[model samples]
Target: MKNLLFTVFTVAALFSACTNDADVKTFVNANGYTIYNDSLISFQKMIIEDGKVRQVGGEELSEMGEVIDVQGKTILPGLIDAHAHVMGLGFQELNINVAGIETLEATLDSIKAYAEANPELEWIQGRGWNQTLWPENEFPTAADLDKVVPDRPVWLTRVDGHAGWGNTKAMEMANISQDTPDPQGGKVIRDRTGKATGVFIDAAESYVTQHIPAPTAEERRLALEKALEKMASEGITSVHDAGIPAQTWELYKKFADEGNMITRIYAMIGGTGNDFDELSKNGPIKSYANDRLALRSVKISADGALGSRGAAMKEPYSDDPGNRGLLFYEQDELNEMVDKSVSNGYQTNIHAIGDRANDVVLNAFEQAIDEFGDQGLRHRIEHAQIVSLEDIPRFKELDLIASMQATHATSDMNMAEDRVGSERIKGGYAWQKFLDQGTVIANGSDFPVEHVNPFFGLYSSVTRQDHEGNPPNGWYPEERLSREETLRSFTLDAAFAAHQEDVLGSLEPGKWADFIIIDRDFFEVPAIEIWQTKVLETWVAGDKVYGNSD
Candidate 1:
């Protein structure tokens, strides 16, 4: 009797769904394309039912639903950033940012202007200062910031977020002194006279940050909304936020519950803090609130970034001798973390920039998989930046995902070789090397570090050059990815990395009807003009989220 009732109920539900003509909509005159079974498939029209794709092909219009004409616009699957910081991107816009400033003097001028404008705040907080861009080509000291805003406690972070520059007043408030010892896995830059230089690297940043006030929930909410708006405008319908604290996790939940989320988020617990202990106990939130949000991964930092010379290399930096760089954890400690994450049903993604850090993370993942088994979770190494040639093949062998940033190569091209030298550069930012070995490379902007534009990544991936088109043929031209390979990295491959390919990556049948209408065909755009590609309309779940209405 129970089986009979269940069968009747299932049949009734199916009948009801099929009878709902109001739920069906057809989009016509679209030059639609999506990756299907590792191949690009094209279609002329798409039929959607109940926020899911029903079919996408050139069939005579027989369905009884509203027919909308897109006027032959190009449509592609929504771009997904495999690794990025949502809140960080939001705050980068909300705060007084100094990114793209050409010189130290100009940066100071901007800082001073911002301080004067916002004198009501107790601490002047800002970011996006890169000393490499300055004529000096050196790290900016607190002295540089002091010359601008001496009275206010100015705290500025470098573009990489691995280092912090604080005014003397800010350091004084933190009680940092010459006698203060550097924390393990971090460094406090000091002068020849043994005095604090007001620059803190990695773990040492806590000395000052601990004193800075945390943003209120309301502030975070605004920041998130701002980030979503930015992403929608850029055609990013989904983003895998690399790390989220408990507060961020809570905010994401709140947004999802309230139906306020415009872009899909795949969040990861920040393993560096106690958020893991509190958040990871429930296993993982595989999907939530109609798949607008998911919390199934944990982000762990293995080492700092290369720009700060804090990346853990097997050999000492070619420029900074006697410093191979700092590792945040020993082999045993990292193994335990990886094992804990995998055993708890979390996809573990570790940030590894230098060769030594890559080696250590690879070992940790191997041990964890051997002990706890991967559970087919597809562990990843974020920023697989300066890996050794020998360890390159391990990515494919371990069935791991290399979550990499393309613009990093173009942005770091000027100084990367100076840090690691000739031989190591061969393996550094080698996207083609990983692709050739059958290893999946998921692309991202690492936004707020690099620009949030996916086209910048696409352009950089193919040309291996900056916006001005440097190095002619390209930087290490042989290592560049083809256009198809680059798009796959940012789209379907990225979705695979986040374990959401079945639902989000492609605009195929049964998947969420998430796609974007572009101003021009991405495939037909010139390599140099790729970065300038404009998103005409962004749609999620068959609803237009961002676009100008005609």
Candidate 2:
């Protein structure tokens, strides 16, 4: 009798939902979990029309087209990763990934194996290598790589993508030698005799990359497609593709038109590219395939990564006192860059991982905002990872968003304290402090560097511990964000950072029906178990992108 009754109601709802609107869809009997006004709420039914959320949780909710019984599973706004390299993740799939390899021998063996299998390849290109995990905790030289692949150039980026390791073949091919002076804002990693050691930090990476053979347009397209599919399967509805070159912009447009863009992309123009002039003069491109693609932001790198010891610290590294790390641009240069970007109507996001870099960039933003009269522009500081106590409240004062990666704290737990010393470490990864001052934090995984799972980021943000539950009380436990705050960091807050909150983030009316269903309610789960939560379904624009064939 119960089965018969459900079947009859489903048919009636389906007929009613499918009335005038061909695209109208109704989801009923859902947990319909969502965050509104900083609190979690649940709705039992929702109506989607014209790819927008038409109504949410009303007893009189009229079904429009097709009706789906979510079976009371936990539903949430589709996850959006505020920081990631989408194209690079796809290429990582195509190349060698030595991400979690712990030992130097394992890394060399993997490179050798990859080269042996792909004899047709011109060069060996891959990422995710951290020398700090090695016994010596020192940078590897070309000689180390030459021991594995002397015949061809091997270029592997450090896990953070801020530094790179190359073999002798790569340096030689690029004409790097003892005479090659270090590029400004970059390091050549020279020996005592001043010979180039095939390790490039920050801006210096361009030297070898410029020499590398570019991926063919088809190869890039394939990579983008792979990334899009992977994101959908992972229950990600939107990805902020960190810094994309001009060539990729054309491909993004093509994919959006053809409806291959299962996941929406909010991109930032690469500052190093020459296409800035054309893009800046034309201002932002806000309406691409009804916001499936958006490019209104410019990405600027103020410094390098913490792991590489290339994040310009206010004081010299505790472990390596001689090194204070690299700063990409002087304040004057940064001020000019911010001025140009904001004046032409672009939101500027600078990568600042260290206290020194954050302070410098903040100063630059302050001066630029003053000069440009930025009206409600949410300029951003990406990876506002390590900051000083005095400069903490300035984020709120300046109305700047702290774009952070939650998993970074867990990943760097062991080394972060030793590198910065206990005093400075207090203000590092200070999520709670930022929140107390009413500063918005947009959280994500710097994927392909950390794991791509959004759950991992949420777990780290809420628990401040690694997967094993280390650091008894959590590393800087007071700095951890509550579960409520962390969810906002990933959802509504992330959308706000990309200037898409009105349509993309929440599961409320007038927003795109982009949401996911999970096996368990994140709020109901034990904090330690959050990372293990599985996504059952992902829907975008009222269409199921992953899971549930019906």
Candidate 3:
């Protein structure tokens, strides 16, 4: 379920591009094109052989190979979601998607509907609920959910995935009560009466999720299948699987061995400190299934999310002045762990949100690099969402990657300034600032948090506005990236983050035969139409994997 191509050229219209006369498939007649090196290239034809790019030239080159027609669509490097959850996307489809619902009633209604439809489910699981979109912007209590599905456990993750709201039954199943102490780096929000509101934040969310039944292997395999299919349809050829448990990584390997792998995954072995320690001792898993999978990265979390009031902050919150946030580790502890991991050659990707978290992580990265020297593993700080103004350039100085999500900017614009205050907001979602300093900003949609659509990210990055073109101008117009810059971030720079730049990321010679054909010229189209540009065909390794099925 990777990308696919359509409108196959009649074999009679082509010849071999190379003298070797190997099995060659030629793609020609694109209305506009771009490759890794240039935003716009003069070439109109490309040749693929043995699942690798063989040649790219003008119409003359097209005459040498069996021409495959693109029907005058725009061709681009298959988009890579630099940071996304692979299986989370599939589960989003399998379970409830309460993503764009505008009101509280709609959220409860969705849960009720899903519960009614799947009565056999002991626990109704879903995500993408945000109180920020609600009328009062107040957290919903368990009583609100109890009004609907009170029989079974209901666990709904907040849109940011940093918090969870559960029904009374769910919390009871976990034995959470007013007396239950919040976990380190987490919270169990309470009301004026000090009753458990059934809202868990950051690490505190484990209280309920740990009790939820794990999906069966077959179920996981199916979710992955569904996930890859969804990814392919979106013109996503490859993704950096944000973090997954060992079982999930093994499941990915099983699929790769079965030759069922379509969407390429650069997996990060995910777990708690113990799991990470064990995995580190066992060491990284570099390549599997002909490089279709690479599990050589470790994911760590520095703090919670800003929306959940869990992200570690240097100062008190602007809106809630009395409350600062939680940090998962002390500076030295985090530094020691990161230093060892990088010294072991594993790409350490840390989830850092608040300025304090970013600052701490950045300092740790600098210390680790100083101690170990550069391993060129391109260690990344995921969701470098809100770096302090003083620490913005530290990303480039330390050679640490700011693996960010563009959609997060537009998604958070509504409540962000209110949370961080106007002065601190200057450093939040500062993409253009990073770019100007030559920091390779790897962009993505932290999928399952935002939409999986890369175009939405592209739209957000270029416009710094939500899909409806809100705020008249962008929320922070000065921070918007150029169209070419955003594309490069999603493609080449994304590959660079995964250490796959030489093999993927572009439609250049000697690279993987990965490219996507879209319905509209992304560059020439009006900015408003950018998100409307649909994937007409997606191809991986010269094989078509998706067409306009609908």
Candidate 2, 8-103: lDDT as tens digits: 111123223346566877787776666665556667778888787777764466755778878878788999899999998989878889897888
Q: Top model by lDDT, which number?
A: 1
Of the candidates numbered 1 and 2, which has the greater TM-score value?
Answer: 1
Clashes of each: 0, 5, 10
Off by over 4 Å in 1: 1-20, 59-64
Is 2 or 3 the stronger prediction by TM-score? 3
lDDT of 3: 0.84
Which pairs of residues have clashing backbones in candidate 2? 17-63, 17-64, 17-65, 18-64, 18-65
lDDT (0-100) at residue 218 of candidate 1? 82
**Each prediction's whole-model lDDT (CA):** 0.88, 0.85, 0.84
1-550 per-residue lDDT for model 3 (tens digits): 2121222222222324365454678777865444445443545677888787777766665444467777777888889999999988888888888987889998888888889999998889999998988888988989999999999999999988899999999999999877889888888899988888988888899999999999887778788999999999999999999888877877888888888888899988674466666666767777677568898898888998888777788999988987879898889889987876787789999999999999999888888888888878899999998889999988989888889999998888888998999998899999988989989989888999999989999998889877788877988899998777888899889989998889888877788888888988777777888888899888888878898824
List pairs with backbone clashes in candidate 3.
3-538, 3-539, 4-538, 4-539, 4-545, 4-546, 15-64, 15-65, 16-64, 17-64
TM-scores of the models, in the order given: 0.95, 0.94, 0.94
Q: Evaluate model 1: give its lDDT.
A: 0.88
What's the residue-level lDDT of 236 in candidate 3? 95
Model 2 ranges off by over 4 Å: 1-22, 58-64, 548-550
Winner of 1 and 3 under TM-score: 1
